[model samples]
Structures are given as C-alpha cells and as structure tokens.
Target chain A: MKVRVGEIDLHVQRLSPDAERAPVVVLVHGMLYDSLASYYFTLGPAFAAAGLDVIMYDLRGHGRSSRPTTGYRLEEHIDDLVGLLDALEIDEPVHLVGNSYGGSIAFGLAAAQPERVASVVAIEAEPPVEAWSQRLGDGLARAKPWLITDEAIDLIKQAKGDHEARLSRGAGKLLQTTTIAEDVLLSRTIDPGLADIRCPVLALYGDESVLMEQVDYLKANLIGCRVVVLPEQGHSVLIERTAETSSLVLDWVREQSLVEAE
Target chain B: MSVDVQTTEAGVLEDLTGMLRVLLEEYGLEDAEITMATKFHEDLELESIDLVTLSGLLREHYGDRINFATFIADKELDEIIALTVGELVIFVVEALR
Candidate 1:
C-alpha cells in the first residue's frame, strides 16, 4: 500500500497475525537496489506466521516509493520512519530489524528517540558514526565514475545477467541523478561510543565481512547488547543465511518481549 | 480427474493468468504469451520484488483464502525461484477449495 508519510509516499506492506496486540516488527532493507522484497520473501512471512505484526516498506528513492531528487540524508530517512509510524497510529514501542544501511537508521532512531524503539536487530550493519559516513562517502565516490557509465553497465550485464544489470543500471541512475551521494555524507553522525541507545540490541555479522571490525567497538560501548558471528559467511548473510537469521531474530525478539512483560 | 475439478482448475488458471498479465504489463511484457509451464524467473524474468506485488494482488482478489506468504514460507529460496505458473495455479485452486 502507498502510505503518505510527510512529503513522500512510502510503499508499505503490513502482515498482521491472527492474534491481537502482537508485537510489531518493522523490517528495514539495505540501500541501492535493495527493497522490502528482501524481507518479504524471507523473514517477513516467517515473522508473521510466528504471530508478529510485520511492517516492511521501501525507503524513499528506492523501489516503489516516491523518489525525490534531494533529501536522502540518514536523519531524513529516520524522520520518514517516524512519520510512517505516526501515520499508522502505532503508539507502542516496536522492534526494529534492519539490514546493512537500514541497521544504521535503526540505531539512529534508537539514539534519537530511545522510547520509540524496544529492541534492535542489526544484520551486517553499523551505527551511523562519522567513520560510517566516511566509509560510505569513499565507497560511493569510488563507484560513482564507473556506475554512471553505459560501458560499465554493459560489462555488469555480461558478467552478472539481466536482473543484476537492471539493478546496476538503477543504482547508476540513483547516483547520477540525485543528491544522495552528497546528502548521505552530510548525515548527522551519532556519537561513536553509542551511549545514547538504551534499548537492547542484537548485532549479527558475517565472520568474513569487513564490517566485523565494528563488532568490538559496539561491544565496548553499548550496555545491553549481543553480537553473533555466523561462520563462513560474508556481507550477504541476510539473503544467504535466511533461515538461521530468522530463527535468531525471532528468538531475540521473543526474549525481549518476555523481558518487557516482566 | 472429475469434470467438476477440471472446470474449477480451468477457472482458477484463467483468473491467475489475468493477474499475471496485469503485473507483466509493468515490465513491458504485456503482450508476452503466458502458459502453465512458464517459469516466473527464467521465462518471464520477473524478480522476487515482482512477487511481492503479485502477493498483494492475490490478497485483493482472493481475500484471506489464499495465503501466498504461508504457501511459500516452507520452500527454500531455490525452490521458490524455480516455481512455475502451474504450481501457483494449483496452490490457489487448492487454497480456495
């Protein structure tokens, strides 16, 4: 469904359980060619079947959501989420499950409005620290040249096939046509120490992922946090390790709910 | 097969084909021929994201009778990727039974 949240219309899918007052679990996907489909095909249905109300939406400038040429900063994405929750009139605190860049947004919201988030499950993601911004800036800067070229797209098509080529083409358009590259760099960086987030957090990472380096920093900072590393995996843990990830998340969310009920 | 079952399956297949055509139009494949054996990923080139939209359309048409999410919940990703139109048609037909 198209939800009017502030300025843009977000494409949202809500899967409600048969039970009443089931805890809400919001699934946020990664950036650039990623959408709610990642969760919809894997974890969203599983979460719903386990009696949780699941909300999945495409972030602005991606998927079916309204894509303006500007306002692609991390804080703006956070505001969009806040507006979406408000528009839905959900008053209770909800669990946030975010992948990649989505995890950064989840941490940002938890930091900015600690009361709105009950718990967080970050899959191969980091908090939006200055270092995070710098990494993204450098990555996007490096890819911008090749991404915007037709030759590069053709090469991707030859190597990866049509679906991936289409995604690459879309990403190229998103990068070339919007302020996202610059705006995301300008996103307000949270404290590197992550002291403001009071909610319980479960961070999942692939043992082989470069982002694993942040695990120690996260453990040293957050008070109530747990980090799990999946063996023989990389950045694609969410898609590649769907079953295990789903089980771990369901267990984590259920445990948090038990704690809340206490 | 009973005459009644054949007729019912035919009706379900026709309806599902219409729904798929509507979805395929967005990808500029509106005029493409669809059949029971047409593979969603290989033949039509429909991405997993397109299935999300199809799920919504299924709910709108069949209400709660067809639980598209639950239907594919147990299937592995590879299985889902290899699904054919006939498989979905049978699932919908059985679901409405």
Candidate 2:
C-alpha cells in the first residue's frame, strides 16, 4: 500500500500493518541502486517473526516509489519518513534499521526528530557529513559515463536484461533530469550537536569498508552509541554476511525494545 | 500444521507461475522466460531487488499463507542465491496445503 507524503505516494509494505500497539521497526534503504529490497530480502520477515511490526518503503525516486523530477534532498528524505510514520498513525518511537546511505537518512530523522526514533542500527553507514555528500556527488559524477550512457543502455536494455534495464532507466532519468546531486551538495551535513540523540545508536562496520571513519565519527559525536566491526566483511556486509546482519539487527532491536519496556 | 491433500502440486505451480509472470512483466521482463526449474539468479537473472519485487507480488496474492522471507530464512546467503523456482513452487504448494 501507499502513504501519500507531500509530492508523491510512498510505497509501503507492512507486516502486521494492523497491529496498533506492536513495537514498530521501520526500514530505510540506500539511494539509487538500493531500495527496501535490501531489508525485505534479509531481516524484514525475521523482524515480523520476532513479533516486531516491520515497515519498509522504497525511498522517493527509487524502487516502486514515485520518481519525482526533484526533491531528493536530505531533508526531503527525512520529511518522507516522518510523514510516513504519521500517516501510519505510529505515534510511539520506532526502531530504525538502515543500511549504507539509508543509515544517513535514519540519522537525519533521528537528529531532526529524536522523539520518533527508538534506536538505530546503522550498517556500513555513510554518515550524512560534508565528506560523504562530496563523495556522493563525486561518485554520481564519476558513474555518469557508464550508468546512463547510450551504449550501456542499449547493451542492458535487451530481452534477457530487463532487470538491469529497469534500474538503469530509472536511475538514468533521475540523474539526467533532477537536482539530486545539487540537493546533496547543498543539504546540511550531520552536525556535531547530534550528540544529544537520546536513543541507543548501534553502529556496525565492515573491517574492510571505506565508511569506518563515518562510523567512528558517529561514535565520537553521538550519545548512546556502540560499535561492532565484522572482521572479514566490507561495505556490502548486508549481503556478504546476510544472516549475521539480520540476526544482529534483530537482537539489537529486541534488546532495545526490552529496554524501552523497562 | 497438517497438509491439505486437496491442493495439488501442479495447481500451486500454475498459481505461482501466473503471479511471477505478472511481476516479471510489470518490471519490464516480459520476454524473460520462467519454468519450474528456472533458477532465480541464473534463469531469470534476478538481482536481490528483483526478488523483493517478486516477494511483494507473492504476498499480495498468497497473503500470510506463503511467507517467502521465512522460506528464505533457513538458507544461507549463498544457498538463497542458488535457489531455483521449483523450490519456491514446492514451498508454496506445501504452505498452501
């Protein structure tokens, strides 16, 4: 189902959508190539099985959510999440499980509206810092040559390559027609004052991941923060170590829920 | 839960196939082929995200009766990467039963 959030309808898939008082676990996916699928393919069902109401949505301009010509700002993403929670009538704090860029958005919401966030489990996180924003801008600028190039599109937009074709086209249009890069460049980087976030923040990093510093930055700045590093993993720990990722996230959420109950 | 003998395996296969076809087409994979033995990654060339789209389709049609995520929970990441369409067919058939 969809929850209309300002400019577009956000596609939401809820496990136990009708559970009025169940502990809510909201999932946020990374940008462009990533979507709710990362969580759905992994921890979503497990969260539901553990009796935590699981909520997953495609970020705007990704997955099945509306692909607007603009509005991909960091603040816009935060608004989308808050608006979605309000639309669902979830007044209480909800556990936020975020992967990569999603972690940044989760932090955006937590910093902007800490009351709505119960706890955060950020994996291979690229914190919303000026450095990461520059990285995103540089990465997208670098990827433009291959991602939406005419030859590349022709090669992937074939009968046997529909999956790649769909993703490419969506991403191509997004980059070609929108101001996402500009938005990212202009949006406020996560501030040092976020140390006031009252929720427990669990930061996990792959030992081989480039975002280790980002995780460390959060640890340095945020309160109630804990860090876990997987020895043999990398940025894609979500997929590289799927079971461990989901189990750890579930365990964290479970423990946090019990803490809240007390 | 006791299996209902009335729901034939072939009948479930048909149901699942139709649902999968709709999803593939919706995702613009209209010409992409599918069979009972089709491996999700190899045959359909599905990315992790594609399985997510398929999972939603299955949920809409089968509801709580077929929990695709739980069906996947038992397998490790590599095992899930190597799963075949027939495995899902059998799981759905048994679950519906």
Candidate 3:
C-alpha cells in the first residue's frame, strides 16, 4: 500500500506474522531497487520465521515509492522511511535492515536521530559521500569500463545468488526510472558519523568483494560493531550466500526481539 | 583505545607497510605507490567508502582485538593523506601493537 511521507508517496509492504507484537523490523531497499523484489531475493521469511513482523518498501524514486524530479537526497530517503513508519502508526523503534545504498541511509537516520532506531544491520554498503565520491572516482580511473549494463546488472544479481525471482522486465523499469543523487554521495562518511550510534550493528561483507574490502577500517570506527565475512563471495553476499546470511541475520533479529503490530 | 605517539619500535612500520602493500597489490596498485604516506583519499584517491571497505581486510588478517575507532581519530588527515609507505607501516604497526 501507499502512504504519504512528506511530499513523496512511499510504496510499502508490511508482512505481519500470524501473531502481532511490538517493534517491527523495517527492510529498506537500496538504489534502483524495490523492497519486495530485492528483500525477498535475499532476506524476508527468515525474520518472519523468527517471530518478527517485517515491513519492506521502496525508497523515493525506487520500487513503488513516489519519484520526484529532484530531492533524491539521502536525507529525503531517511525522511521517507521515518514518514512511512509514522504514517503506519508503529510506535516502537524499529530494527532497520538496509542493503547497498539503503545501508548508508540507515546509518544516516540512526546518526541523526538515535531514538528512532532500535538497531541496524548494514550490508556491503559504501560508507558515505566524500568517501563514496572518492571511491567512485578511483573506481572510474582504475577499474575498466565504467558503463552499467543489463547483463552486468544480471551478473550482479547472480553474484548475489538470487532464487526468489529472476529480474523481470518490470523490475528493470523500476530500476531505470529512478534517479540517484550525486550530492547525497558527497555528504556523509559512515565511519566518522558512526561514533554517535548507540545501537548494536552487524556489518557484513563478502570476503572477495572489492567494494567493501576495507573491513578493518569500518570495525575501527564503529562503536559496538560486529563483522561477518562470507568467504568466496563479493559485494553481493546477500545473494551469493543467502541461506547463511539469512540465518545469521535472523539469529540477530531473534536476539533483539523486535516485533510489532500496526 | 587511542593511537600511541611515543613509541620507537624498530621495523614495526616496515612490517605494517609490507602487509598494507600486499593488500593494495591485490587491487592492482604498485608496492612503491601503496606507501604509508598514501592518503587514502587524495594520493590513492581512496574514497572514505574505500577506507570503510578496506578496514575489513585489516580485521581479517589482524583479528578483532584491534580498536578501529581509536586508530581513525589518532592521526591527522594530512598524515594519512597520500600516506608514505613508511608512514603507513608505522601507523599500522603502532595501531596493532
């Protein structure tokens, strides 16, 4: 269903367990992807089976959320998430799970307003703006062939090891129409900002992934941080190692005991 | 939990530098270029994100006992800017020890 979050209209899917509870877990998707499509491919029922209510949604300009001509800022993304929860009237703080760019947004929200988050789990996401831009620039310079393609995208999904569903034409449309902001990529570094976080964080990365190869630096900067590496995988650890990733995440969520009803 | 500045440990810097160089080499950078002075952002053009990503590698080889937060705030950005191979070696050795 759609809910109004500030000026944007967000598309969300709330999967409640057979029983209702408190502190629902919200699954926020990354750039050019929708929550239902992406989260289902990686982690969904794992949390549900653990007795937590799951809420998934597309951020503005991705999936089913409202797409503004501008305002694709990371802050906008965070606001959208906040607005979604507020609109849904879920009173308790949420256990947020973010993937890729969504992970960065989750950190942004937690850093800016700690009271709103019960905990956070960030997957192979880039840190923040200055760092992200520098990395992108370096990647453009050192890495060959900068263009993103359908096949490359497919390969990325495969590398993540998706079994939920192959990328449909509709999914491509969902990705293509959304706009990503460069300003958002220039503003925050997750490490420097992480000091403000009081919640527990489980930061996961693929052992062989070049994008998040700097695990030690992240661990160094984040307070109360835990790291997990999936061997023989890359940036797409969620897909490449779905069962293991799901198991680890579900176990973490179970321990947190965050479930809610609207 | 913070970076120590008063130590004069021998070969510590070189050893740390050697380990970093090996990791950098995996990314196709030259051993000569991956020095301690290699500023993760400027000289190497490593984005802050790269620094975040790179930290994982250190944890993998070094183990989790190392304090990541202390290591970051201890040094000057300029010192880490285009870190020299020698400087990086010293930084890691001291931080790890």
Candidate 4:
C-alpha cells in the first residue's frame, strides 16, 4: 500500500491482512539494488507464519515508492519510518529488523527513540558513528561506476528480450534519472550515539563479511547487545542464507518477547 | 519443480486462467495464450519480484481463503524460480476448495 510520509509516498507491505493486535515487527531495507522485495520474498511469510505481523517498506526513491530527488540522508529516513508507523497507528513497542543500510536506519531510530523500539536486529548493518562518514564516502566512490557511469547505464539499457527490457528501464530510472546515487553519498550527522540506544539488540554478520570491524564496534559500543557470526556467510548473507537467517530472527524475537513478558 | 494436480479446481481454472492472462500481460505475454501448462519463468519470463506481485494479487483478491505461498514455501529459491503457472493455479484451487 502507498503510505504518504512527509510529501513522499512510501510503499508498505504487510504480511497478513488480519494483522490487528499481533506482535508487530517492522522491516527496513538496504539502499541501492535493495527493496522491500528482499524481505517480502524470504523472511516476511516466515514471520507471518510464526504469528507476527510483519511490516516492510521501500526506502525513499526505491521500489514502487515515489522517488523524490532528495531526502536520502539517515535523519529523513528515520522521520519517514516514524511517520509511517504513526500513519499506520502502530503505537506499541515493535521489533525493528534491518539489512545493510536498513540496519543503519534501525540503529538511528533505536538511538533516537529507544522507547519506541522493543528490540533491534541488525543484519549486516553497522550502527551510525562519526567515522562512518568516511566509510560511506569511500563506498560511494567504489559504487559510482556501476551506478553513474554512462557505460554502465548503457549496458543496463541493453537488456535482451522483451521481459528483461521492462526491468531494465525501471532500473535505469532508479539509478540514472533519480538523484539517489548522488544523494546517498552525503549522510547527515546522526544526532544520537550508540550509547544512547538502550534497547535489547542483536547484531548478525557473516564471518566472511567485509564489515567485521563494524560488528566489533557494535559489540563494544551498544549497550546490552549480542553479536552473531554466521558461518561461511558474507555481506549478502540474507540472500545466501535465507532460511538460517530467518530462523535466527524468529528465534531472537521469541526470546526477546519472552524476556519482556517476564 | 513437481506440480501436484490432485488439488486442481476444474470449475475455477477458466476464470483463473483469464486472471493470469491479465496479470502476465505486464511480462510481455499475451493473455489469450496463457494456459494451465504455461511456465512462469520459462514461458512468461517472470522474475522473482513478478512472482511476488502475482502472489500479492492472489492474496488480495482471495484473502486468507487461498494460501498461495504454501505452494512455493517448501521449495528452495531455485525451485520457486522454476515454478510454472499451472502449479500456482492448482495451489489456489486447492486452497479455495
């Protein structure tokens, strides 16, 4: 469904239609080449089957949502998420699950409004830190070729066959026409620190993932946090290990709920 | 992928076929040519997102009455990618019945 949040239309998908009063678990997705489809295809139905009402949304300028030429910063994303929750009338403390960039948003929100978040599960995401500014800059430099180069854009447009042609055009619009590539390179200062996040947190990263140092930083900084390393998995662990990752999330949420009730 | 035809709904197949045609049109397939035997990935060349959309549409129209995800639930990613249109139709048919 199209959720209007601060002049932007966000695409929100619920796992079940009759989701009133169920344990709410909201999912946030990664930036660039990631959408609500990642969770919608893999973990969402699993969560719904486990009796949790799952919510996943496309970030600004991604998926079926409207691509505003700006607002790619973390603060805007936090506002977009909080506003969407308000629009949906979800007042209870809900579990927040995020992958890669989505994990960063989850971290920002939990730090900003710890009370609103029951627990946070970061899948291959790092908490917002001052040092991340440089990291994001370096990452953006590496990504510029595939994202902004005219040759890459031409190659994306040259998708063969009629079926792929449609996907190629849509992808080109997301990458070339929108300001996502440029907007994402600049991240606003995250107001709250990881020390400010008081909620229960579980961080997951592949043992082989390049972001191991970030995971170590998460363990050292965030209060009441536990980190897990998936064996033989990497940054794309969500796709490479869907069943195991979903199982981990399902079990984590259950344990967290039990502790909260007690 | 193995398609279980035991749950096929003879009554609803025609209406379901028509719906499939309209839905599959976005994938460059003609609605008139979509049949019970049409493959989702091979014939229609539908991507994972497309299957997700199809499932969402099925759930929207039929609600919880027809659990379409169960058809692809047990399958691995590759198996889901290989599923045919007939498999999906039968799953919906069985759920409705």
Candidate 5:
C-alpha cells in the first residue's frame, strides 16, 4: 500500500495482524530505492513470519513514491517515517531494521527520536556521519571512477539489472554528491545524538567484508552495539547470505525476548 | 650493486602507489586523485573508515596479494605524493615478486 507522509507519497508495505498486541518491526531501505519491491521481497516476509508486525516503505523519490529533484535529505526521510508511525497510530516503540544506507537512516531516527525505537538491527552500515563520509569518499576513489556521471537519476533507475550494470548504478549514486543529502542522514557532523539510546543494537556484516575489519572499532565505541560477521560474504550479505541473515535476525529477536523475560 | 638502493628508494615507492590505486579503484574509488603526498587524512581525505572499508574490499579480491595492515601504515600521504602511476606499478610488481 502507499501512504502520503507530507508533500510526497510513500510506498508502504505493512505486515502482521491488525491486532494491537502484535510486535512491530519497521524495515527502512537505503538511498535511491524503495521497500515494497526492493529488499522487502526477501527480508520483510522473514521478519513477519518471525511473529512481528512488519512495516517497510520506499523513501521519497524511490519505488512508487512521487519523485522530486530535491528533498531526499535524511531528516526528510526520518520525518516521513515518523509521520507514518503517527498515522498508523502505533503507540508503542517498534523494532527497527535497516540495510546499507537504510541503516544510516535507521540510526538517525533512533538517535533523534529515541522514544520511537525499541531496538535496532543495522546491516552493513557505519555509525554517525564523519566516519561514514570519509569511508564513502574512499570507496568512490577505489571502486569505479567512470560511475560518477551527470545523469544520476537515469543511472539509478537502471540499477536493477545484471552485475556490471548494478555496480554502475550503485556507483553512480554514491559519486553524485549533490543528489545525496549529505548532512541530513549520513553527514560527518550528525552524531547519533541520543546519549540515552541504551537499546540493544545488532551490527552485522559479511566476514570477508572489508568493513568487518572495523566492526570491532564500532562495537568498542557504540554504547550497546554487538557485532557479528557473516562468514564468506561481501557487502550484500542479505542477498548473498540470505539464510544466515534470516537466522541471525530470528535468533536476535528471540534473544531479546529472553532478556525481557528476565 | 647500487640497484637495490635505486629500486627501494624511488622504484619501490612508485610501484606501490600504482598498485594501491588499482586496488582502490577496484573498490570503487577510481577518481581517488591520490598522490604520494596524499595523507590518508589531510591530503587525500582518507579516514579510518575508508581504510577499514578498503581493507574489507581488499580481503575479498586481493587477499593473497597484499597485507592491509602493513601497507596501510607504510604509505603516508607525503611519501605517496612524489610517485607516478607507472612507478607505483613497478613497486607492486617487485613486492609481488
């Protein structure tokens, strides 16, 4: 289904019983993509079957939502998410899951509005802005230079193709500084400002992933973050290592339940 | 006799940077604009996050070819600035050899 958050329309996929007592899970996708037909095709149903109410939405300018040249800022995305929760009338804080860029947005929301979040499952995303930006810059320099192009929108639209094309699309988006709402969600200055965010955070990455080497640093720094590296996978752990990803998330939710029982 | 001195002093440095650039490009940073003087921080604008991410990418593609920790620590920005792409290539070739 689709919902209008503010000026723009958002594509939303909500799962679970209409019953109020059901646990809630919200899945947020990263930049230039939406939820319904994106990552949700795999990750969302798995979470829903794990006995939680699941919510997934396409960010503005993505999926079935209205596309504008601007307003793709992280704050705008967060506000849209808040608006969705409010409209749905979900009075309780919900479990949040985010992947890649979506992970950054999820962390931003949790840090800014701690009242709306219970726990977070961040996949292949880094903390705050400073580190992420520098990493982004480096990744751009190393991966593929030809990806930086003037026509980023067209490139992103063509992203769902084969490997080389997908890589180009992903690179095109990453290199375009203007299209990316740099400071809003994944800026260098935006600290996950909520000091009281003692909520459990599960940080997962692929074992062979270059980012895995630094997961230790993130775990050491973040207050209540735990790190797990999926063996033999790269950046797209959700797709490349789907079964393991599902099991890890399921085990985490179950573990949280046990902790609550105590 | 004096070959080792010339090779290590200038030849090795150039070769290393070239290889590093290729590695960086493979990870998606082809426009890195790297120079010998490009400090991972001040000059080239690389941070721990970049290094970490690059190391992760490297582990996947060039695992047998390089040692991330040692290579990362060894190449300071200024040390890298004087080298060219071709020289950098030779350095890596020697290292691999």
Candidate 6:
C-alpha cells in the first residue's frame, strides 16, 4: 500500500496474525539497492507468523516509494518514520528492526524520540556516530567513481550477473541523481546522546564482519544493549544466515515482550 | 492429464502471466514471452525485490486462499533463485484447492 507519510508516499506492507493488539515490529531495509523486499521475503512473514504485527516499508527513493530529488538526511528519515507512525495511528511504542543503513535511522529515532521505540534489533549496523559518518562518507566517496561509470556497470554485469548489475545500476542512479550522498554525510551525529536511548537494543553482527568493531561501543554506551556474534558469518548475515538470524530476532523480541509484561 | 486439471493449470498460468506482464511493464518488457519454463531471476532478470511486488499482486488476486510466503518458506535460497513460473502456478492451483 502507498501510505502518505508527510511529503512522500511510502510503499508499506503489513502482515499481522489473527490476534489483535500484537506487538508491532517495523522492518527497515538497507539503502540504495535495498528495499522492503529484503524483509518481505525473509523476516516479515516469519515475524507475522510468530504473532508480531510486522510492518515493512520502502524508504524514500527506494523500491516503490516516492523518489524526491532531495531530503535524504538521517533526521529526515527519522521524520519519515515519525510521520508514518502518526499516519498509521499507532500510539503504542513499536519495536524496530533495521538492517544496514536502516539501523542507523532506527537508532536515531530511538535517541530523538525515546518514548516511541520499545526495543531495537540492529543487524550489521551502527548508530550515526561520528565514526559511522566518516566511514560512510569515505565509502561513498570511493564508490562514486566506480558506480557512476558505464564501463564499471558493464564489467559488473559480465562478472556478476544481470540481477547484480541491475542493482548496481539502480544504486548508481540514486547516488548520481539525488542529494543522498551529501545529505547522509551531513546527518547529525548522535555520539554524545547515545545514553539517552533507554530502550532495549539487540545488536547482531557476523563475527568476521568489520561492523563488529561497533559492538563494544554500543554495549558501553547504551544501557540495555546486548551483542551477539554469529560465527562463520559475514556482512550479509540476514541473507546468508536467514534461519539463524530469524531465530535470534524472534527470541530477542520474545524476551523483550516478556520483560515488558513483568 | 485430465481435462479439468489442464484447464485449472492453464487458468492459474494465465493469471500469473498477466501479473508478470504488468510487473515487466516498468522495464519495457511487458510483451516478453512468459511460459512455464521461464525462470524468474534468469529469463525475466527480476531482482529479489520484484518478487515482493509479485507476492502483493498474488494476494490481491487470491486473497487468503494462496499464501505465497508459506509456499516459499520451506525452499532454500538457491531453489528460490532457480524458481520457475510453472512451480508457482502449481502452488497457486494446489493452494486454491
């Protein structure tokens, strides 16, 4: 469904169990080539089947969502989430499950509006800390030249496949045509305010992933944060380790709900 | 095969083909040939995201009778990647039963 959330219309999908008043869990996908489909095919149905009201939406400029040429800042993404919750009239605090860049937005929302988030499960993600901003900026800067070139895209098509090449092409377009790269770099860093997010957080990372570097930082900063490292896994934990990731997420949400009930 | 089974399979295939055509319109491949042998990822060159949209169309048409998620849940990633139009048509037909 195309939902009017503030200025843009976001493509949102909801999968709920037969029961009413189930805890809401919003699944936020990664950036660029990623969309709500990542969760739709993996976690969305699983969570819904487990009795959680699962909500998945395409971020602006991704998937079926409205693609404005601007407004891709971190806070703007947070604002989108806030507006979406209001538009949906969901008053209760909802759990947040974010992957990659989506996790940064989830953390930003939790810090910005602590009352709205019940718990957060971040998979291969970090909050928009100074380090994160710097890393993302450098990464995007390095990728820009390679991504924007037709030669590179064609090479990718030959080396990878049509599907991968298509994804790269979309990502290249997003980077070239929008202010996303610059806007994301200008995102307000929540480094100092990390302690303000009082809600429980479950940070999942592949043991071999470079993202594990942020796990200690998260544990040291957030009051109720728990870290889990999946051995023999890499950055693509959600896709590569779907069953394990699913079980871990379900267990974490279940635990959080049990804590809430007490 | 029985006449009834053939008709039902053909009906499901036609419905899926229509959905695929609509989905392919964005890529200017609306007129692309769609058959039971067509592989979603390979022949259609559909990203995983396209499957999400297809699932939505399936829901709108079949309602609660066909659960696309459960149908694919048991399959491995490779199986899903190599999925054929015929497999989905069969699932939808059996589900509608």
TM-score of each: 0.93, 0.85, 0.60, 0.82, 0.61, 0.94
- B-chain TM-score, candidate 4: 0.73
Checking candidate 4 for backbone clashes, the offending pairs are none
Candidate 5 deviant stretches above 4 angstroms: A33-36, A137-145, A148-178, A181-188, A192-196, A257-262, B1-97
Candidate 4 per-residue lDDT, tens place, A64-121, comes to: 6778877777878899999999999888889999999898889889888877899999
> Residue A38 in model 1: shift from native, Å?
0.6
Docking class of 2: acceptable
The residue-by-residue lDDT of candidate 3 on B13-70, one tens digit each, is: 4444455565566557644464444555445543322343344445554565443324
Docking class of 5: incorrect
State the TM-score for model 5: 0.61
* Candidate closest to the true structure, highest TM-score: 6
Question: What are the runs in model 1 whose C-alpha is more than 4 Å off?
Answer: A154-159, B1-7
Model 5 Cα shift for residue B59 (angstroms): 45
User: Each prediction's Cα RMSD?
Assistant: 2.9, 4.1, 20.2, 5.0, 18.1, 2.7
Clashes of each: 0, 0, 42, 0, 29, 0
Is candidate 2 or 4 superior in TM-score?
2
Ranked candidates, highest TM-score first? 6, 1, 2, 4, 5, 3
Worst 10 residues of 2 chain B by lDDT: B1-10
Taken over the whole model, the C-alpha lDDT of each candidate is: 0.89, 0.78, 0.61, 0.75, 0.61, 0.87
The stretch of ten residues in a row with the least summed lDDT in candidate 2 chain A is: A158-167
CA displacement after TM-score superposition, residue B24 of candidate 3 (Å): 49
Name the top DockQ candidate.
6
Query: What's the iRMSD of model 1?
Result: 1.6
Give the alpha carbon lDDT tens digit for every residue of A43-151 in model 6.
8888999999999999999999999999998999999999998999998899999999999999999888999999989999989888888888778767766898989
